[model samples]
Each structure stands twice: as structure tokens, then as C-alpha cells.
Target chain A: MPTQILYKPLTPEQEKRRRQRNIAIALSVAALVAIFYAITLVRLGSNVFLRPD
Target chain B: MSLVSESDLGQQSDFGSAASDASPSDYVALLKPRVMSLSIFTAFAGMLMAPHPVHPMIGAIALLAIAVGAGASGALNMWYDSDIDRLMARTANRPIPAGRMARGEALAFGLVLSAFAVLTLGLAANWLAGGLLAFTIFYYVVVYTMWLKRSTPQNIVIGGAAGALPPMVGYAAAAGSLDLSSLLLFTLIFVWTPPHFWSLALVKAGDYGRAGVPMAPNVWGPDATRLQILLYSLLLAPIGALPWILGYAGPVYGAIACLGGLGMILGGWAVFSRREGDLARKTAMRNFGFSILYLFTLFAVLVVERLTTIWLGA
Candidate 1:
């Protein structure tokens, strides 16, 4: 026989923690992407931003 | 038995489906990020070592493709070896084995990433780099994981070529071809792999035995494995010195390489001399740790020397 299982809603504190963790992860990934971009700019040298003309 | 309600069936199905649910982190875990980092660093070194200049955007894209390809290979390996991985303590908690991700999901993810990496590289960079990336993925997944890992004790020895080829790929990306310097980089990593991996195998022989994988220490006995490590170390030391001999690296790099090479040889000697028990395990691990340091130091010196030469015109 199959048994029924009820879904439980998260408590306020648990929801807060989940939101915080997600934000942290999103920020970390954003930081990593930014760093890769910065490295690319540096590698491209002054010619990227400066023009002799 | 009484008939079950539709609600009960729905709940049961939901409970069953929960096990297959995966988070973003689970997908990332399939990538083996540490291994990808090593590939990225070595490939970056190869790109920097090239005599020809690469457009920065192209170089970045090439590296990104290499990293994705490495991750794809790692994911495929995890998917195929999930059964043995469950048997081994060290890998028992990987995504597939731990049930965080399904086997089919991992397989599809790996295949998608592999195609994405290869196609992106082919379109953005030269076809040669893309071709090499595709070949590396095929070699690691098909040759190493599916075939050699279970069949032979020489698994790492032969399979190390896939790991060794990233530098060549990077060189091809930057310069559109390879040269002696890039080949030396490839050779150095190839020779270093055996001693590094064998040391780990010595420590994990029981795990490998349990998993039915024919690692060197299990097949050849610890004594023979130690001797092999020593022999490889001897070959590796001279190969480590080749960058300077070829006039690519400066004297500082040469000195560090010589000292690091000697240290690697001595570490191997320590492993070889301590023939049994915990002492042998410790020494083997020490050799393993030193081998990583040796490779990192050699590459670091090369990169630093090149950067300084370009910056200061020294």
C-alpha cells in the first residue's frame, strides 16, 4: 500500500538562511566572472583603452 | 489489499522523485573543479610561453574552452565509475554515488559540455586546438576511464597523455602550432605523473583493490611500485631541466628546477627505501606532495621569468 506524505513549509528562520546562502553563492559567481574579465583586460594591454591617434 | 487513493500515489511518486532532484552545486561537483584548475593553469602557461602573440580575447576563450573540456572529461569519468566510486571510501560521496545527481543526468551534462567546449573553441580559435580538446576528452573518457582503468596496472602511465596534452593545445591556440618548448612541457608533465599517481596508489591500494581497479601497488606489489616511482623520478629530473637547457627559461628557473628535481628524486628514494608498513606510506605520501610542489615551482618560475622579461625588458 502507498502512504501519503505531506509537504512542510519552511520556517521564517530557515527561509532567511536559504535566501542568505543563495545570495552568497550568486555573489561568489559574480565575483569570479568579474575577475576573469579583469584579467582579460589586463592581458589586452594599454592598447585596449589608449589610442595613439 | 484495499485500493490506494490517487493522493497517496501522487505523494509516493513525489517522494521517489525527490532522490533525483539536484541543485546547481551538484552539477558543479560533477566538474571536478580542482582538476580543471590544474589544466587551466598549465594551459595558461603554455599559452604564455608561445613566441607568437595571441589576441587576449582569443586566449581567454581558448582557456575557457579547455577548462570546460576538462570538466566534461571529469564528469564522464564520474558517470562511468560511479559504481566503483561507491565502493571506494574516498569517492563514495561524489554526486552520482551519493545520489545527489542521477547517472543519466551526469552523462548528458558531460556530453553537452564536451560539445560546447569543442565547438566554441573551433569557432573562436583555430581548429587544431578544438580538435585536440575533442581528442583529449575522447582519450580520457573512452581510453582511460572505460578501458585501461579496470584492465591494466599501467593505467596512469598511458592515460597520463590526456592530461599532458593540454599544454600542446594551448600552444596551438596561441601560436597555431607546437614547438620543442611546448613538447618539453608536455614531456615534463607526462614523466611526473607516474611517480605522483603511484605514491597515491601506494596509500590507497586497499581502496583500489576493493573497487576492482588494477592500480600499480595492487598488481605489482608495493616494492615494485616504489622502484617504478624511483625510475620515473630519475627520468623526470633531467626532463625538468630541459626548459633551461633549451634556452627558454632563465638561470633562476634552472636552479629551482635542478633543486626541485633533486628533491623529487630524494622523495622517491625515501619511498623506495622504506619498504613496508606506515613508514612507507608516509614516505610515499611525502613524495606525492613533493611532486606537486616540484611541478608547481618549475612552472611558477617559468611564468614569472617570462612576465618579468616582458615587463622590464630585462
Candidate 2:
């Protein structure tokens, strides 16, 4: 076998594919954090932006 | 002159070099995402029904920890069972057995996830949650993977404890302690697992027997295991209804629990009615398919009721 670590570093096309996945995971995790924070804001009985006192 | 000679063929799989693309989905497969999803959903339901409130931030983190903990167990399971997994067609395509990821990588991933999950649950939730998470890992890896599976006919029966702990972990995450309701959730899954898995074993008996896996159907014979399935399903009905009987849920949830469990009974009966072979395989497949939905629907009803109570302040 080509050295296990060296059995073809991913071709450029594969690297680009991997890059897209990396971006998706990063975006998803970041969006998850933001969504959870918003849920917390609402779950705690906060609708401040929508309320007019 | 063929490019693929005997010498080249010998070199193909040396030291985990394989042709499969190792993409993000492959790593997600390493997490056993279906199992993680079930664990997360059930645990979240337990948290919702617990006595004390959890901060939503902490709740999300706690759920993530539980999901990670379940994933760690899965990775470890894949590591240990890769041998049998390769032998069985149903599991042959998994990340480890299919050689999509190296055994060493899977092992390290599991260990790291194990540590991170337990420690984070402890900090974000409570020691009880953390402790339960740790024990779940040990139970799945040590008890199910190492001891009971290969050694005993009642492997899944006795080893179902690890699979049943998710709700308890979730309950403790919210309340910082255990309660009868959560333990009831634990017991329900525990009772449900034997019948659930035995149904699968019914259909896969040949594969298991080929792998020398000592499944109940292979060792104890199909008729006995099918009867055992009926007996457990018979037992599961009453206990499955305990939450509503205990008064945590209203009639809507109670009726659904009863009916869903009754569906399992009918499915088990369908298996019980058949003689072993393709006939029994079809029946067992019915039972196996319904069992997953049965548990999910039962829990889903509980969640729906909880959300309704919160919405209407019922």
C-alpha cells in the first residue's frame, strides 16, 4: 500500500469538497449557538423587542 | 499485463489504506448518529419533565454532552465489535468494519469524546448527570461489548441497562438528582430492549450464528426467543403505562402509551404465531420495525403533552 498516511493526499477536487464540508459544519455549529441563545432569550419570558410598554 | 496483479492486490489494504472517500458523513457515521439522535430526544424529554428548571444554554450543552456520550459509546462499540460486525451483513457497512476509518482513529475519537462528554456534563449539569453518563459508557463498552454479548444468551436482556440510562441522565441534568418518574423511564426502555433486539435477532439469526455471536435465537432456538419476546411485550404494556398512572401525564398521553404498547404486543404476537423461517422473518421484521416507532411515539406523546401544558399552563 502507499504509506497509510500517504495513500494520496486528497486530490484538489476532494480537498475542495472537504473544504465545503468544513465550512458547513462551522456554519451549522455557529448558527446552533445563536439559535440556542435566542431560544434562551424567549424561554426566559423575554420578548422585549416586540413589546411596547 | 494487468495493472492489478497478485502482488498489488496484497498491498491494497495494508495498514488501513483503502479506496473509500473519508468524508464528514463517514465521521458522523462513526458517531452512530441515529442512536445519538434517539438518546438526545429522549433525554431532552426527561429534562423537560423534571421538577426543576434548567437554563436553556446549560440545557443545550447538557444535551450536546449526552449526544457526545452516546456517540462515544457507539465508537467504542464499533471498535470492539468490528470483528463480528464484519461477519454480519447488516453491520458490515459500518465505518470501522467497512474500513472507512482506522480502528486507532475510532478508538481515540471514542476516548476523547468520552472524557469531554462526562466532564462537560459534570460542569454544565450536575455530578449525577456526569456520573450516569460515565456509567452508561462503561456499561455499553465493558458490559455489553466485552462481557455479556459473547458470553451469554441473555446478553441484550441483562446489558440493556446502558441503553436505558439516557432519560435518567437527562432528568438528573435538570433536577440534579434522580426521581421515580425518570427511573420509570429507564425501566420502560430496559424492558422494551429485549423484545426490540430479539426481533432483530430473529431476522438475523443466520448472520449471528455464522459470526458465533450467541444470539438467543441461535442458542436458545427461535420458538423460545419468540415466546420470550411475547412475554416481555406482555410485561412492557403495564410498566409502559406507569407514567400516566403515576399522574405526571394526562389522559391523552396515557391512551397513546397504552395503544402504542398494544401495537407492540400485536406485532410480537404476529411473530409468536409464526414458525421460524421466512415466515417468522417477516413477522419479526414487523415487530422490529414497530418497536422503534412504538417507543418514539410513546415518548413523543409525552413530549407533546408537556409542551401543551407549558403553552396553556394546564
Candidate 3:
């Protein structure tokens, strides 16, 4: 026999908190991406646009 | 789909755990933002005092990574010490202790941030600074928090090195190496930490005692702790003036360091002599307050002098 899965519903407060955590995580990831992009550009400097044929 | 048992599900929610009630602020609290801010300030001073001018962008990111690393250590500390934290009134309201968040969550958060902060710092700045930041986090989490905090009275003395490294890391981030000047900044904070913390420990011995943490005032008697505070204060005075004596800082810093060092010695003396009832607590509190002002004033003077020279093209 296959194992049964149980589902439980979240209260309104729990849902709201979960939403907040998700949003915060999303924003933090976005900020990290921006930081990486900025560091790459600054480190590459004038060489950023250069490529050898 | 298989049939589900309500008993297996019980009261558990699909959306969250016991930490479900945690808000963003709770997570911020886990980071210990106040301590993080102090690290950032001192690191900025160290960066400014360095000979080489880092690209503004690199400096900003390096500071950010250092701040995040400091926060990660604080989070890890809270995670490991949640039990003792719950026992102490001072730390009772912290997220894990207050039941707003779970210890596992804090541990995961801390570990993830630590990796990110160290790696980003290495890529943004140099590996030397990144290595120092990694050592700081590791020393604080493993040596200070796990090994020493509960086991010894000298916890903060050895652990203070972790706190003192911010300026060294900042200097390395900018200069790509350490100097006597950077080491002096580290030493200033390192020597200052014992007296600074012991004063508060004197005031909060009861809390630390209850938590079973062997703070100086609790492990050694309060009188011994007081004497130790005075001794450290005596050492801190000259060390605080070293930047000026070594010719790295201006006379303004020398004057301020002398005055502030005098104040610190006086505060230490007050705490030392006033060993009775309300007077002792009051003196300890006063010393605690002055120590903060003392370090901040010294660093502020250094930063201002650096900026002045930079601006005047000196």
C-alpha cells in the first residue's frame, strides 16, 4: 500500500507571515544579484567592453 | 492519491512551523543589529585610515559583507545559546528564546549568511580580508560561543579578539595588508573589551549566574572582577593613545585619548572603590556607559582627522 499524505490548512496569521518571509527572501536575493552585478562591472572597469577578434 | 489520516496531520500547518509567527523584524533581531552597527562603524574607520583609497563601490560592498558576517555570528550565537538565553532576563526576549523563531531556522540562517558573506567578501576585495572575516566568524561561533562562554570567566577576554578584528579586516580590505596602525586599532578594542564587559557583568551578575555562564563577576567574586576591570582600564589607557604616539593620528586624538583614558581610569576607580550596595551598581553602570563613549570618541576623532587630511590635501 502507498503511504498516505496528510494536508493541513494555515491560519490567516500564518499565511500572512509566510507571505512576508517570501517577500523578504525575494528582495534579499534581488539585492544579492545587484551586488554581484555591481562588483563585476567595477572589477572589469575599462576591460568590460573589450574582446579580442 | 492515498487516503490521509487527520491524526497524522494533527495541529501542524502546511504553511509554517512554530516559527510561523516570526516577522521580518524577528529575523533582524536574530542578526543583533546593534552589535552589527558597531562593527560597521569601526570597520569604516579602519578603512578610512588605510593608506590606499579603495574604489567606493568595493569599500561599500566590503563593509556590507563584514556587517552581514558579524550578524551571522550573532545569529549563530543566539542559536547555540537559546537555552541559556531563555533562562536569562536580558536575553529572554530574543527570537528563539521568546518562541518567535526556531533554533534550527536561526542556525540555517546563520550558516547560509556566513558562507555568502565570506565568499562575496573574497570576490569583492582580497582573500586576506575575506580570510580574516571567516576567522572572526569561526572564532566567535566555535571558540567563544561554544567552547568558552559557558565554561570560563575569561570568555570575553579571548572572545574579544573576534570583535576586535573588524578594523583589521577593514584595513586589509583597503590596503591589502596589515600595519602597526591597524593592529593598534584592534588592540585598542581588544584591551577595552574586558573592562567594558566586566563592568556590565558586575551589574548583571545575577542574570549571568542564573544562566550558568561563568562571567567574571560571577566566577570570580565581584571584588576580583572590579580589580580586573581597573587593571584592564590601566592597560587600555596607553593602548588607546598609541595611534597618536606612533604618529599615525593627530594631537587632537592624543588629547582626546588622554582625557578619555583619564575618564576611563576614573570610572574604573569609582567602580573599584564603591563596593557597597547601590553605589557599586551605580558606579558599574556609569563605567559601562563611559566605556562606550570612550571608544566611540577615539574612533570618531581618528576618522575626522583622516577626513580632514584627505580634504586639505595634507
Candidate 4:
């Protein structure tokens, strides 16, 4: 059997802030992904099509 | 029988309950977004003025990295200076000092972002720019915040170098090497920093004294700080015109630089001469405000000149 987990309940304010933080982290990760994609495209340029199989 | 120790419980409580209240904006506040904006502007100007063209996407990414790097240093600064920050009225409301964020949280945030920023810049641009950004972060966090700020009056004087380096980093990102033009931009900000900061320090001497940070005015007395401000202003005036004299910039930029330099000199003289009461405070405040506009105007002029030259082939 799995050991019982324990956690403290967050205050309403704390819960809201935590939600905001999670959203921010999600947005930042998305932005990072977008940046990486853009940079790869820019760096590859026309050469991306010329890649040998 | 309790499985957790008292110390472990304490740690968990501090990290979990308190941390949950720190919003993303508080994290952004740790980044010192205003300072980051200035760095971004100067870095963008540097990129525009580079001898070679930069791919727009690459340049954007490089700027983003520089901005992130600047923010990282700021977070580290807030982390290290949290104790003193609580003592100063101006800085007392900062995220760390205000109890919105924990110091360890800030430190981890700074270090992680710093690593990400440096690595991203190195990959997105060239390593030279990345290296410069890394050094800048180190200089601001280690040399300026951790060491000089507490040790000597000349902290801002020497520490100014870190703040002055974004443009050079941007130029390197674009051209992959340093140039006289880039160095001149660095020099302009370098010379402009003292009067810009000292004027504010004159007003905030009490705050510095309370915090035990040896700002020039607090340590050297207001008169010496005023004189130093004037001296730096005099130096800054000519340095501002260097780009124009060197012929990289056209007459428009030269005119703005000269007029702006004159404005600085006049502002410096006002601060120097009026050293008595409310008038003194007003002058110093005026100088402090104008000095920001002075640097911004100079860089903005350069950016416009470069853009016009690129578009019109002038």
C-alpha cells in the first residue's frame, strides 16, 4: 500500500496567487518554446530545405 | 511519533505557505523591469548601429536574452540587498523587502534565469555577446551588489560599468566584435552615471546612511558629491558629442548631443550652485530626472539615425 500523503490547505489568497504563478509559468514555457522555434527557423533559413535525408 | 523534525517543519511551512502568496508580478518586480527596459533600449540601439546587419529574429532573441540577463542580475541584487533594502524608504517596498518573496526563492530564480539567459544568448547570437552578458551579470551581482555597495563610496562609480555594457553586448551580438562606436556608447553611459546617480544620492543620503551603504554623498559629504557631479557632467558633455565628432552620426544627432550635453551642464551647475534648502533638493531632483532623459535622448537619436541610414541609404 502507498504511504498516506499530507498537505496543508492553502488560504484563498494563497490559492489565487498559486494559480497566477502557474499561469505565468505556463506562459513563460510557451514563450520559450516559441522563441526556440523562431530561432531555429531563422538560423536554418533556406538551408533547412536542403537537409539530406 | 513525529516523522518530521522541527526544523524540517519550519522549512516546509516557510517555503510552502509563504511562497504560495508570491504572485508572478512579484517575480517580475524582482527582475526590476524598469532597469531591464533601459538595457533593452540601449542594446537595441547597439544592435541597430552594428557594422553588419543582424537577422531580425536573431536580434529579437538576443535582446530578449539580454533583457532576461539584466533581470536576473536585478533579482540577485534584490536577494543580496534585501536586508539593507528594508532600511531604505525607496527600496523598502521591493518584493523581497516587502515580504512578498523569500530570499532563497529570489536567489534560485536569479541563478536559473541567469543560466538560461546566458546559454540562450550564446546559442541565439554569438558566444562573444553571450560572454559579455555573463560578465555583466557577474559584475552587477558580485562586484557591484555583493562587494562594492557595502564597502566604499565609489560603488556606483565603479559599479556603473555593469549598467553601461548592454549596448556593447548588443553590438557584439550583431557584429560578433567590439567597435569604437559601441565603446563610445559605453563611455557615454559610463560618464553619465555619476551625475545621474549622485544627484539622487544627494537627496537619498539619509536613506543610504541608514542602510549603511556608502553612497558618494553619504560618505564624501554633499559638497564633494556635488563637485564630482559637476566634473562628471563636464566630462559627459564632450563624450556625448564623440559619436558626432567621429562622423558615425550625422548633423541631427550632433545637434541633439550638443544641446543635450549643454542641458546636462546646466543641470549640473544648478545642482552645484543651489546647495542650501528646498531649492537644493529641487535642483538635485531636476538633475536626476533630466539625466535619465539625457541618456535616453542620446541613444534614441543614435537609433533613429541608424534606422534612417538603413532605410534611406543616406
Docking class of 4: acceptable
Cand. 1: chain B TM-score: 0.93
Residue-level lDDT tens digits of model 2 in B1-314: 44444445433342333332456676678789998999998898899788756887788889999999999999889888889899999899998788666676678778988998898788777889999999999999999999999999999988999889999999999899888989899999999999999999988899999899899999999999989999999999989899999998789879988998898888888888997568778889889989999899888988888877776763
lDDT of 1 by residue, B146-234 (tens): 99999999999999999998988888888888899889999999999999999999999999999999999999999999999999999
Candidate whose DockQ is highest: 3
State the fnat of candidate 3 relative to the true structure. 0.65
Q: Per-residue CA lDDT of candidate 4, range B228-255, in tens? A: 9999999999999999999878898899
**Model 2 reaches what TM-score against the true structure?**
0.84
Model 1 alpha-carbon miss at residue B6, Å: 8.5
Q: TM-score (0 to 1) for chain A, all models?
A: 0.69, 0.70, 0.86, 0.80
Q: What is the lDDT for A19 in model 1? A: 65
lDDT of 3 by residue, B111-159 (tens): 9999999999999999999999999999999999999998999999999
Q: Ranking by DockQ, best first?
A: 3, 4, 2, 1
Highest lDDT among the candidates is held by which one?
Answer: 3
Ranking by lDDT: 3, 4, 1, 2
Instruction: Give Cα distance to truth, residue A21, candidate 1, Å.
Output: 14
What is the TM-score, restricted to chain A, for candidate 1? 0.69
Predicted structure 4, TM vs. truth: 0.95
